[model samples]
Target: MSGIHLAYDLSFTHTEGRWNQPGAWVGSDFPDVKMFLELARTAERAGVDMLFFGDGSGIPSTWRGSIEPAVEWGIQWPRQDMSPIIAAMSTVTDHIGFGLTYSSTFMHPFYVARLLNSLDHVSGGRIAFNVVASSRGADAANYGYAQLADHDQRYERMEEFIAVCRALWDSVSPDAIERDRATGRFADPAKVHPIDHTGEFFTVKGPLSAVPSPQHHPVVVQAGNSPRGVAASATFADLVFGFGGSLAGQQRHRAMLDAALVDEGRDPAAVGILWATQVIVGRTAAEAITRRDTVLDFWTHEAVGTMLSHNAGYDFSTLPESFRLGELREEIIAANASPAGFIGALVTELGADTVITRDEFFEHGFLAASGLDHTVIGDAATVAETLEQNHADTGARGGFMLSSPLAMPSAYAELSELLVPELRRRGALAPRYPGSTLRENLAV
Candidate 1:
């Protein structure tokens, strides 16, 4: 087995009211701080590599069958902020790396540089940034834009934005800071360089206000999964997330990304490829299947529909279960051209008869129902073997960003207790975090 790292998705804001039934659980039922602390402890104790938070600026109005909007959809609405939460989590855990998603479209590069630098110091150098170009109109409205920019245009702006951020981060060298008590002098002026950058999208002046971080720069994680997204990842990202339903499909995507990195004059080994998998582990295959079925029995159809509606950019709730893939593909293409163009082609290649019922889409991707890929459900040893095989076959450096069934903490416990130990015994998963910094853990 190659280097296998673990990451768990932490969503502080729980979707309780969105369900049709009144008895469904929500954020109020489970406290975010408690959940976060538990997850941090659990992951650290299990020797997990990282804890990643997926965030968004706004909720889609179509999610609740209302243009007016009923529930807070994304991270910003539920959590309000992430930096503070990450700071708290960092203090509570010892070794696990921390990561959060931030958009280049809405934030200033200097501010982002300063904040991320501070996070790196606070986390003891365990920090990563997942760069994204916001696609929602609501997020654009908050930033004073009339509408969201076109997909390609956003990516182009992102390229300049990331460049400016990197320059700002490198402006102040680590040796520049000197706490000289006798002369009361701090930070030598000679070592601090000003980034007087004037780009197409932004103009920034000078060094970041914060001192240089231990990691030099936060690990860059990109997850666009489109042609333009792949190109950007090749140029900028240290790790790129790939989307697919099978090992073969994932390998093809990985090859494409690797080729893109080579074309951009980057070392392919420097960029890790991580595939998303929803995991279900038990003592045996039968036990795992039973657990999965039990969870599916209680799965809320309405909640699933709401999530799909937000992603597909239309209310899938109203569509018939027997809706043709061709019709849905055309509709999605007409609505949001870029995501549909990329996703539609991939979906067709996987197989069009892949019916995307509300239940199936939420369980994993639409094609997961075929059992070809997506969710990895089996006993501890079986799941470990599969992970080892996939890593060996694909040359993917990172491990599964394990998506749980319902609650973040509960799902984490299952993986840590069952799958992780088995992988360790097989010499697949790391026995301990190899280094103090996020980069070291990933590189190991």
Candidate 2:
């Protein structure tokens, strides 16, 4: 089996320390650039595969309300841009891959291709693209659209968008440049092909402005679990991100993705699977539990209600907290009939009693076990052992994308000091990066 590909989902605007706090955005703090560089270096030393950013173009008014209330009530908030920070981080770390999230819905394919190509060059082929079709309705308006595109339509546009980008990358071959200074000739025009791509969503005239990077193209990653989302990923994604309440559930998702990939005429083995996880580890299980509970206690019912309302796009505040689970599912179905089926499936699996009220849901959501397939809160060796079992049982391509509940740097520091060394001793972690590019690291 392949080794675990560990990664940190860094938020430029949503800093790591406020992860468990409702309405807390990590990126807002503008954590010292030096701090980010050091953290990247730490992950590298700890044998992480990549340090990635989760981003959005605009904040919705609903979320803004939550933030304002939290601020007035003396709560924490985080926000920051991830692209330039990763670029800076790359200069300070040797082998770790850096990823930036860019929405396919807002940006042009030509611009995205050129920007990422330059980043790949600057980072020496250690860059990746986390493609997203923006979820927030306000974000679309901010970008000059009257309303956000429907979820399925966004995926349709993304399909054509990615195809064009790939073609643009192929347009300018690496060897196209001649650089004959004496003759005042630079590149071989004949070698640089014109894409002349015309598609349903996008049209490009010629080759990309920038040359292809050493990695050839940045690795493409997708993070969505809906049916349309699965189809989009199956067609182009190199990695798929999934969320589940149990190991069996995660395995089911993996099977679904594999089937989708096979349908696309792509080898399932070529794509990697990463589960999102939040781990709180300490010297003892008791210590870990205490820490986890402390974070959960900070989350209030109002905060959770606000967060969920924004996510579901229906005001849950007006609804009764004592609303029955069946009633809530029906309400959700009425509001967004598309994802209702998936939501209903989750509620059924977790059971009505297990699902919490709007207020309780926010607090419960912070609990590692509530959302993650595997939650490790114990001694280092025990944590490492559980990870090994998970890998063996599921045959997942990689490990979790670690989420820090609080103090991003400190959480990672603990991971480095406690978890990493033990994993190495047990031969579950890599002592050094196996290759130079993100593709090579993930593929291996």
Candidate 3:
């Protein structure tokens, strides 16, 4: 890899815990074609490789078994479809790929394949489908499931899901598109083949109706930390979005993913693992700390608790402010298995007897407040140095997915003008986007 690949984890909802934060155009600017177009242009100019939009399928109803807190906090709700925004951005920017979050848990392979295949062609192959195996119960309910499938089984669903999509994408060969105007023939019928796939989770039939795009199939991106998730990524993902936190945690993730890839009969280096992180930059270290503090100040304990309650599938609001992990054993099992495991990990680190008060959990457990478990906060030089060194240490070729909690444009502005240039100078950032297509740029 020439340099670290950076992607903006694009948020469609108003950012920051508070809606009225300065520079927030929550009601007006969201889903605005022009606003996203400008954002895409700015990121592309900054040598950002992709605009990866994170999405959820349903409104969060897990918190207190109510959607009020999620709606009140704007915690990943009021969701807008990313397809239109991606289409608009693709028209204006040539090199910035669009990574769209679509769940394998809910959607059929044929639908996903057709939608992305068309998008890839329209975007000149600057598109990636960020495959997610849906986790939330509310999301499952919307998709006709009484509850989310068992964790390992969900990954099995994902494995079959991607297999069907790949088969559909490959159904029509690249050479199938002949476009012979003289003969009034747009494609070669002989080159098209039916997928006819019937798996345990899904039954997808026939060749895709659409022709193949530049990349054939848009880059497959997966972000699952479970063992089954690693296997799914190893089998299908071109790029893996990793959970960011400790150097050790990420290293372990990469090691397992690499091992999984080898087990799947693929080269370890062929896939990319991108860490999901936040960049808090300032002109000076103190300034960066101040900025980070300001962002933290916006997160209220209740807001964070509500977010966590939705994520873990247990009502934090119902628990006492001071509760021990042992007290919630039954509730923990009732919650999602992955989050229960996360709690177990935290207990192992902090001692299971460790009391997890609502205040602490609120302050540190909410993803945005938690900085997705890892955050880089410093002056431009320090931030660049930390990111470079960590990337070097983690052995992740696909780099950081940058975002800010404050919904401030200035953070990104500083990144473009200060931090990104510093990384480039250190030979850690790509000098320019390598090519017009996402695959080409990522291949660099």
Question: What TM-score does each of the candidates earn?
Answer: 0.85, 0.87, 0.92
How high is the lDDT of residue 177 in model 2?
85
Alpha carbon lDDT of each predicted model: 0.70, 0.69, 0.76
> What residue pairs clash in candidate 1, if any at all?
none
Find the candidate with the highest lDDT and give its number: 3
TM-score of 3: 0.92
What candidate 1 gets wrong by more than 4 Å, as runs, is 12-31, 63-80, 297-301, 315-342, 350-373
Across residues 1-444, which tens digit of lDDT does each residue of candidate 2 receive?
A: 767777776642232225434334345434568768778888888888888787755543344344464344323234456677888998988789987888898989998889899989888889888888765554566689765667688889888888888998899888988889999898988879889998878889978888779887889888766778888999999887666347776777788788999999998877877776666778787877776665655445555544444445445556656555666766654543234223444465666556456555444433321322245667777878887787666674766676656555667777777887787888875436768887787773
Worst 10 residues of 1 by lDDT: 16-25
Cα-lDDT of candidate 1: 0.70
TM-score quality measure for candidate 2: 0.87
List, residue by residue over 126-239, the lDDT tens digit for candidate 1.
999988877665566668986567677778888888899899889998899999999999979998998999988999987788789989899988887677888888889988
Tens-digit lDDT string for candidate 3 (1-444): 447888888663364452454445545556677767877788878788888888887787876788877777677677787898898888898788999989888888888889999899889889999988777777888878887677778789888888898888889988888889899998888899888887798877779988788889799899887777888889889999987777777888899999999998999887878887887788899977876676666567766766666556666677788877665754665554345334534554566567987767555566544464678888889988888888889874778887765453445666777887788888887547667688888882
